[model samples]
Target: MPTGSGANQATFAGELSVDGSTVSIRRDTDVASERVSVSLPAVVSVTDQTGEARYPAFKAIMGAKKKPIQTMSLADLGVDAAQVGWSGASSKVVDVSPTPARTAGTIVNDDGTGAAQLADFLAGRGFI
Candidate 1:
């Protein structure tokens, strides 16, 4: 990936989940997603199987709180010398958008009669 100043680049390979609107990233196998509303116990039990470097990982996590992150010019990091930016990156955004709005309406519950009411409501809009 092309690296440069003003570039917001972060590298992470781990399981993640979203609880409602909050996202939780786990370095272990306990992955969860509100979109799916489920936990992958089998997946969580397999993080050790990868057998990746652990010491560097420990240092990285520990360094986050104590280390003084220095802000330097791109030339100091050799990025400016290489002139890496969007021009150097392999990917470019062509277009972007948000998901379309839901066309369905809420179903009002009238106790045990909610089923028939729901059907009638949807049929009124030809949604059935």
Candidate 2:
């Protein structure tokens, strides 16, 4: 399985691999987490929280030690290195501030009267 986790939170992306007998799920790892590889045997069904049965064959390939995972540089993949990562990311956030609190509005006392008031307000604003 493939998972991403840290000190305060974790999120599972999906399973890394599964064979007929075993399944590998991804999970978030903390700084102290260890990497492990295990073997699993013949296929079966996998169900998620929504009660949907997953077709094993349609699942993605699981990660394994036997197969080497190659890490290639962006230039190696035919992408310009200068246009990747921090250099390529658009829109930098300079600062963030909390929004001002809003004041309370007058409450409608009558349902029938409120409907007409609402319609007039919306109409004046060109919303209706």
* Each prediction's whole-model lDDT (CA): 0.53, 0.53
For candidate 2, write residues 1-128 as lDDT tens digits: 22232222222423445456444545444553322334443232222422456554423344343567789876677888678778988878899999999998656777678888888878988999
Q: Which ten residues in a row have the lowest lDDT in candidate 2?
A: 1-10
For each candidate, what TM-score against the reference? Answer: 0.33, 0.29
**Reference-based lDDT, residue 124, model 1:** 95
Q: List the candidate 1 regions with Cα displacement exceeding 4 Å.
A: 1-71, 115-128
- Per-candidate total of colliding backbone pairs: 1, 21
User: Candidate 2: deviation at residue 10, Å?
Assistant: 36
Tell me each candidate's RMSD, in Å, in order.
13.9, 16.9
- Ten-residue segment with the worst summed lDDT in candidate 1? 34-43
Give the candidate number with the greatest TM-score: 1
